[model samples]
Target: MSGWALRTEGLVKTFTLHLQGGARLPVLYGVDLSVASGECVALAGPSGAGKSTLMRCLYGNYGAEGGRILIRHRGETVDLTAADARLVREVRRETLGHVSQFLRVIPRVPSLDIVAEPLVARGMAPDAARAEARALLSRLNMPPALHALPPATFSGGEQQRVNLARGFAPGYPVLLLDEPTASLDAANRDVAVALIREAKAAGAAVVGIFHDTDVRDRVADRLFTVEPRPEASRSAA
Candidate 1:
């Protein structure tokens, strides 16, 4: 438990876009990050400051321009930068969990399936997955009768809770949350924060990108901020 769960060294990322004028842009200039086992770290920054991009890099959604990402899995250390998509997916599905800025739910998939997806992905039997999902949903204060319903029509807070239940369903050891409480009202925000604390208590290493100061203060054991350095104007001497 003393070892790090995730570590990144000299991580870098850039975005190049083709416009009518075709210009390139640069983002994420060599970031170094590390999260200890069972630690809760908050990533906070202004808009367009690359917090999401950093998450993407850590999760292997986007390849870093230059750096290494190391993930500790099942008593072994693996360099995520060198792992294939299939391997990354395996780690993501089994050992690492992610909650997105926007909830991504299938149009026709039932809420139970959404929560059970992680366990099923890890090859648990359908019945077992359903049982676990139900327990998690109940822990979120979800009504037992509504466990079978599609969550699209639920309130924003309910939807976020469903999202939480799904991400936590498999009990993945590490969780990366992007604005997990972004859409909640005051009361619901408290619920979301409590759930977050529960995750940390259950020994999951959690990194959350927070926009709200209160949310950061509530859930963060450590904090990070992204700042941009000013580019001095060029003048001929």
Candidate 2:
């Protein structure tokens, strides 16, 4: 309910290559960023610069090694970095929603049902959930015939649209999007951009990784660049 929906201070993350003798690879180092309700913050960086990693840390998908991932929910600030699994799940269910670049769902579930799941979980009637999902899919230009089929057989762009529909359906207070426009054509990309702007106008705090500069320019209120840690700093740590 505050001006800032999310903030991170000196956040850090490292991945261990257990398959390769437990070698450590640090992706994010001391990242400090914030996003406010009614604002969209785009993550800008070259490949491998940890933009996606930082987003995941915000969504509580990746555990940070250091620093704070603070989220404002229902007029209280919660430290996502230190929150337990139950708390994290509760927050995600009620406040934060995420759309990864890939669509990972049950292999046989219809696309409509997949998109309706979040709304249904939030206590919306099943009929209303599916109706909203259908509307979103139509806006995204998904064919009506494909709505009842599993997205597992859909093309990458189609699957991404389904992912977008699902992510936007919940209308959570905070949303994290990774490459939302990555697989869309110009027309569909424009649709995606409009949907993002609509979410902003509806007062959702958005943090996203948009490789498409035009989409980013159109939707982002500001940019947060994620830079790789210097070798000297890494060696010292």
Candidate 3:
């Protein structure tokens, strides 16, 4: 709710395709962006424009080739782009949360436990975390009978709901979401929007890829468009 919770200065990323004679594919180049606490910033662009790639870079899943990904964590600013692996892990554990388009969890873990794991890792009692997870899943309209089942058995929409519940549960200071409502129906999408608004109101800086314009409009304070640099420019670089 004060200064910027996240900022990227001249961020650059490229993928080297070993299969294609080490062709360098530049996805992000000198991308500068910022999101203040209590703000929701939407990344908008055509498909394959690197929206998701930027989110992953911000989350430290993908390394940036240049520039800084500055994140405010525990009252300190750390550049994730250059931070050590341990520091990045600590930041992710205590300050950043991410919700991806797909659900990835241990194959045999129950949906309830899957949603509660973050909370438990952060020192919440297992019972309390499970209770909170159950409540969130219920709010998302997940059936009670399916709570004990593994998310692997759930439908795409249902798995997405579980993913959302987990990402929102920790209430981290910074959140990166990639199509958070991608597999949802209208009703569930509305619920997801409400949760995003609630996060912003609570002073979480949110950066997201929202393909659904209506949801983007409802939650985004601003938009950052990712445009691929021309091939000629890449070669020159």
Best by TM-score: 3
Off by over 4 Å in 3: none
For model 1, residues 1-237, the per-residue Cα lDDT tens digits are 347888888876766557635443556776778888668999877787788988988888888877898888877877888898888988898788898876776887778889998888789999999999998888777898778888888887778878988887777788899888887778667877887788788888888898888988988998877654233311110
| Clash list (residue pairs), candidate 2 | none
lDDT, model 2: 0.91
Error of 3 at 20 (Å): 2.0
Which candidate tops lDDT? 3
Candidate 2 off by > 4 Å: none
C-alpha-based local distance difference test score of model 3: 0.93
The RMSD of every model to the true structure, in order and in angstroms, is 3.1, 1.5, 1.3
Query: Higher-lDDT candidate among 2 and 3?
Result: 3
How many clashes in each structure? Answer: 0, 0, 0
Clashing pairs in 3: none
Model 1 residue runs over 4 Å out of place are 19-22, 229-237
Greater TM-score among 1 and 2 belongs to 2
